[model samples]
Target chain A: MHKTALFLAAALLACAAHAAAPKPAKPARSAADVLKDSPTSDWRALDPDNTLLMDLAAGQVIIELAPRFAPAHAANIRALAHGGYWDGLAIVRVQDNFVTQWGDPDGDDAAKARPLPAGASPKLPAEFSVPIERIGKSAGFTKLPDVDGWAPRAGFAQGFPVAADPRTGQAWLAHCYGMVGAGRSDAVDSSNGTELYVVIGHAPRGLDLNITVVGRVLKGMELLSALPRGTGAMGFYDKPEQRVGIQHVRLLADVPVAERPALQVLKTDSTTWQQLLDARRFRGGWYVHSPAHVDICSAGVPTRPAP
Target chain B: MHKTALFLAAALLACAAHAAAPKPAKPARSAADVLKDSPTSDWRALDPDNTLLMDLAAGQVIIELAPRFAPAHAANIRALAHGGYWDGLAIVRVQDNFVTQWGDPDGDDAAKARPLPAGASPKLPAEFSVPIERIGKSAGFTKLPDVDGWAPRAGFAQGFPVAADPRTGQAWLAHCYGMVGAGRSDAVDSSNGTELYVVIGHAPRGLDLNITVVGRVLKGMELLSALPRGTGAMGFYDKPEQRVGIQHVRLLADVPVAERPALQVLKTDSTTWQQLLDARRFRGGWYVHSPAHVDICSAGVPTRPAP
Candidate 1:
């Protein structure tokens, strides 16, 4: 087990299986190597209030909500989750190279849709974006070097990849792989935080501001992403049995201390994080030619075992 | 069965399910709708000479080798395919949001590795990229409006998403979702066309000139992308039973007429293709905001049920 952990650690740092590459006489240290030596202060644990745990037959999924950006949606989700609104729900959609959506499978059929528990908001004003000036004080906005096609500037805000339009003073979470958002109708304010989806493929950045993003899956994204693609409409499951059942949904705050997951995400604003990006943007190991630029979506936000 | 198809058509065209919002009286036609109206001439049939077919238990994966860019690798692959080089091999790795790699399970161990077929080339020099000027006249270089961080211009060249660095006068296939590349060791020229991996998530554009991208998966990407992620190092299956078995692989030319998949891909230079992009970029119907920009990866090359 110890040996396997060491291999996994090195593999994760490399980000690719370049283990077959012959080591140079004095191999230049890689980004993974730089991260391995990071200071303890470079990582931060999940805030229990913001962390939501989703249990499936395969495994537990970890999500860190962005209440600072979508307070109403986040709050509504918390209430619904605490009241066990989604305990027996099933994942209804898995579009290949797109998104995986889950909630009440009958969410479209109002007559059959499950009742919303009291205190859970049934509707939410489009919390598509938050003014950067408003959340700038509390949020950590670590800017990337390149300009984003979707917005004037792109970066990570409190661990979530984000795009910002400084002229409008607005910044919102980018729809990168693993991003979770409320599924909405044509109306901008239709999302009520019940039907939700997570991007499972290429970062559909154009969806920014068009959808109400809530959080991102920090772990077990594979449980959702790797599901069979539905042949039905919008990748919806045609048969009830095809849907994956949700065993339970619990906020970290509600879990007993002994049972909570031990997790910590690298601090995007830390010096270690900057070094990691530098190493990736200017890769040194095995690669013959290194690209000077890195896309915001391709730059993975590192997560590690908690302290 | 017919009802399900209609529902899927409407759902894909509508773009999303609006559970509560009033349906638009005259819903704006979407990218799907626009493509549905495209003239038959807009699409070209997949060339049997360039097409390669992979069979698995679940489905058949179709790939179109780009001889225009990586001819030597393409030629070697053709020779390997005709020799039944990949029969009974196993898909050994599935890294979530990364790639699905396949080939001989014992590839890394020379003692156990499968022998290179009688006529197959071994230790081919890296064919990472091609000069645009060399292939410029023969290939279609339909440039997108925006600049890619990795390259001065990005767009499609001969039906594949590509990036071009005008400064270097070189253009290479972008490592977008569904792209296939030769897996190699630390040595740049070590690849012998035996191991392969496909991009299953965000476009890893940084890898443009770092590795030899031989082709792109034209169909059945879901068969590979949606597989269970392996738990071992680099997402290799910890146990042999977990590996997905390959039935056979053959170039379309080697297959009889009855066995060939009838496929057509939209031509990049067609007016219909432009209209599709325009519809996606300046979405007319339900969306409140239509991004003026579209990332090269999001513009999926449309495929149709062949005539």
Candidate 2:
């Protein structure tokens, strides 16, 4: 809705102002322009320790964790990773326009549940919300210039999309597409960082600050996104054969250094990133008209092979 | 961004006034409360002329057109509907975290392209935006209380989700999940309403006001939403056998009266609708904490058997 207003306002202003002042016209800067002029320092390197590489038959997906936000879940997840908790698990749910969840398929039943590996916490306090102080000053939270109906401030923090409430002094990662969150039952504390789901449809912002978001799928999102929708309740595959098997999930540090994914996420604080946002904000050349506002989720973060 | 500021300001004002007064024993009213108190006169019924009934293997899907927003495309689509253009076409693309598109599988090749049947326009002006005057005063264009990065005023106009600019008096539909749009090539004017796509992922606001959005799938979205993703670029199926055939798409009025779907969408401007919105805006009972703001796309428009 915020983006809708910005888009209309920007377009109207441009059209009206352009007609009123035809000569020596100054063009409005697009999101791309802002990114183009941004300094390289705005970018940050991905911490390999915080990265997880999920290999599938199609390709490998890179996920960077938000340990600063969900430290406990991140730690437990790390333990699960090191212990190969998900090596034999399968993506058991692919609900169209909703999510794709993966974990121990038998976790739902208490009788046949998989045991938590050593180092993994059997239970932990819900890491849904955290103190805003944990968000480092250098996180490059380029706050969206528009107003949001959901949070006091909505923007990128430490390369992860986030929303915060100044009044509550609480901040949390938003449930944008590709964002990975720990799955839970009716109980708020039911999640144990073993069962996880990645948002694969509309940004379920409603889930923001309500669940612990561990990381975001940086690559191979297409592979997971393309999985067949499950037939059971909430998109769970009723039959075990309906699920897609996961080849493996390995931490970059655990693998041979040379075999790790060579990747770099564009620094959110860098000028290049700002320019990228601007470019998308203001469509040029081929675009007959440009939208004035850009939603935090609509903005794309560039990634590439490490230089 | 705009919504965030408004919420903060409101919260601040509420806090300041309550600082001196004893906390009221009653629950705090939410944005939904403001809407629930709206008069009954604000509500309106769906226009049968602008409605379409799409019967799928799973169930029925109802779509309401925004003729004022995209007249040319709507007209072309209506013609196609009458001519049974999509009677045997299939849903050919299901791009993960993106869209579910339906159209002639051979649209790319001119030789295989089906000619616009009698009464259908082979070429029509892109109906991306329309004059604001056409949107009536009784349209209930209550702008969202937030600032959008995309449009001047993002809100509902006559029960249809819309974006507008007061300055230019231009308005168009926003592309949210379940919203349908005409599919086209790189050429801005290529779409003639024969091919259609539905937003099934995060609101692709970038496409807002860029393409012609005809209507939204009112039900059975999961049927199309859950399809397997195509392997080809843009999520096109690599093999011809992969396409899911469309049994037929007929206007509800054209079908036998006894065969019509007995469904009704919650009147967007109704008190019940406002209460639903409030319920979501201030999820209280089970929720540990509620998100201060809710995205328009996430708002529920209830559907059930007509009384």
Top-scoring candidate (TM-score): 1
TM-score of chain A of each: 0.89, 0.86
TM-score of each: 0.90, 0.83
RMSD of each: 7.1, 6.2
Task: Identify the runs in model 1 with alpha carbons over 4 angstroms from their true place.
Answer: A1-29, A135-137, B1-29
Candidate 2 residue-wise lDDT, A154-255, digit = tens: 778767888776677888888888999998765778788898899988787767866778989887787787777787877889999988888888877799
Task: Note the DockQ of each predicted structure.
Answer: 0.36, 0.32
- Model 2 agreement with the true structure over B61-80: per-residue lDDT tens digits: 67777777888888778778
Residues forming the 10-long window of minimal summed lDDT in candidate 1 chain B: B1-10
For model 2 chain A, the run of ten residues with the poorest summed lDDT: A1-10
Instruction: State residue B252's C-alpha deviation in candidate 2, in Å.
Output: 2.3
Please compute the TM-score of chain B alone for each predicted structure, in the order given: 0.88, 0.83
**A142, model 2: CA deviation in Å?**
3.1
Model 2 chain B scores worst on lDDT over the 10 consecutive residues at B1-10
**Distance from true location, Cα of B299 in model 2, Å:** 1.2
